[model samples]
Target: MRAVILAGGQGTRLKPYTAVLPKPLMPVGDMPIVEILIRQLQSNGVDRITFALGHLAHLVQAVLGNGKRYGVEIDYSIEDKRLGTSGPLSLIRDLNETFLVLNGDVLTDLDFLDITRFHADQKSTITIACHKRSVNIDYGVIHRDGFRVTEYEEKPVIELYVSMGVYVFEPAVLSYVDPETYLDFPDLVNRLIHKNEQVKIYPYDGIWFDLGRFEDFNRVHEIWDDLKPKILSHE
Candidate 1:
């Protein structure tokens, strides 16, 4: 199977580090973030990958270099300009079959093979990998019914399901994405939903982290040695 990684983001949230290096090239353990993702995909039976690159594209290419060292065939789709998330996929003409798409900065133990199979079984045009998250309100939130004041819940935590930036998309879904336009994944999903297209979501309850911020980067560094063995066992 082929996987397309969105590795071109400017990663503004990660300042000094990203100033010198692309977010995907930032070190997590002993390897760069994109390298870890490539290794994980290799372990999961995916050996062909296309990296959608923009900011500091050459540096990423130089570091990864055809992916032969990692047991994968690596190619790149250089974006002349920033093409949000889904927009980059439109540039990859070879993805006529179902393929996996993910953000390079995400660290997860999700089973890619399982997600691919699930997408096929469900016959969904797009399958999003979702995770449940909770947000707590700092103050009491009042629920009002008409003019009467209803019950007030103090510091209630709301549970919400969100995309983990991992997706399985059939080629048919490409019709929904506009070529040469900047579009985010969420907007594409919304368009699919509005058109009554089958857009399924597979929930994952596993080890996952988005190393987009300084705190997350530091957190991964702290747990690198402990998590490396389990996540990179095949390497």
Candidate 2:
């Protein structure tokens, strides 16, 4: 399988740490997060990987270095200026077959082979890997009908299905993207919907985290002992 990993974000949320090191290069347990991702993909049968990079691109290339050590052939597509999430895809070439796209900073033990099979069986234009997350609301909520309160609930928990920044895409999907334009993943999905393309989601209940967030980054380190085994099982 071929995959494109998005590692270009400025990681503004991560601040000082990201100022010097790209989020993907940030250590999770002992190795960088992107290294874990590459190993996972390689073990799951992905042989070719491309990095879509911008900020600190040179550093990423320096650290990863052709992916030979990781058991995959690595290449890169660098953006001259900022291109929203999906826009970077326009810069990559030879994506004439089905491919996978995902964030490089994500930490997840999801089986790439399974998602690839799911996408193939469904014959979907795009498939997004999804995880269920429960968000806690601190404030009270109220329901009103023209200023008359009908119901109220305090500190409710809401469950939502969020994208894990992992995706399977058919090459045809690129038709909607205008080269060199700023386009985020959400906007691209909206466009796919407008065009009546088959866009689906694979619901996964497993280990997943966006290391871009400070809290999640800290949490990973807090449980590194346990996470290390599951995340790097192939290694």
Candidate 3:
């Protein structure tokens, strides 16, 4: 199976560390975050992996080096300019069938095979891995009507299903990507949906962490020794 890992984004939330290293190269135990991702993918039947790189591309190349040590066929799609998520897809070559796209900075045990099967069975142009997250407000929220307080919800919790930065795309979806255009996954999904094209979500109930912020990075650092064994397939 083939997988495209998005490793280019400058993780603004991760600041200093990302200033020196690409977000995917940030440490997530003894190995770089992307290393775990690669090993997991390799163990999960992803034989060929392509990294879409931009910021600090040279360092990434220096470190990974064609993925030989990791036991996978590695390739790269360098972004001369910053291309938002799906925009990089337009630059990658020879994507003629259903394939996987995922964020390199993610820590998850999501079963790629199951989702790929789901995408094929549904025949969807795109399948997003979704996770349910609950956000809690720190302050009370007030609802008012004509300067009168109708109700007050004290620190209400909001629940939402958010993309885990994992996706499966069929070849037909590429037509929606215009060459050299700045397109994101959401933009592509909306276009497909508007056209009545098949776009679906594979809801996941599993460990999913994105090392995009210090809080997330710190959380993983705190628990990864125990957590890593559970999430990584190759380990």
By TM-score, who's the top model here? Answer: 1
Off by over 4 Å in 1: none
Order by TM-score, highest first: 1, 2, 3
Number of clashes recorded per candidate:
0, 0, 0
Candidate 1 vs candidate 3, lDDT winner: 1
* Candidate 1 lDDT by residue in tens digits, 55-135: 999999999999999999999999998779889988989887889999988988888889999999999989999999999
In model 2, the worst 10-residue window by lDDT is 226-235
Q: How far is candidate 2 from the true structure (C-alpha RMSD, Å)?
A: 1.4
For candidate 2, the per-residue lDDT at 195 reads 92
Model 3 misplaced regions, further than 4 Å? 138-154
Clashing pairs in model 1?
none
Return the TM-score for candidate 1, rounded to 2 decimals: 0.96
* Candidate with maximal lDDT: 2
User: Residue 68 of model 2: what lDDT?
Assistant: 90
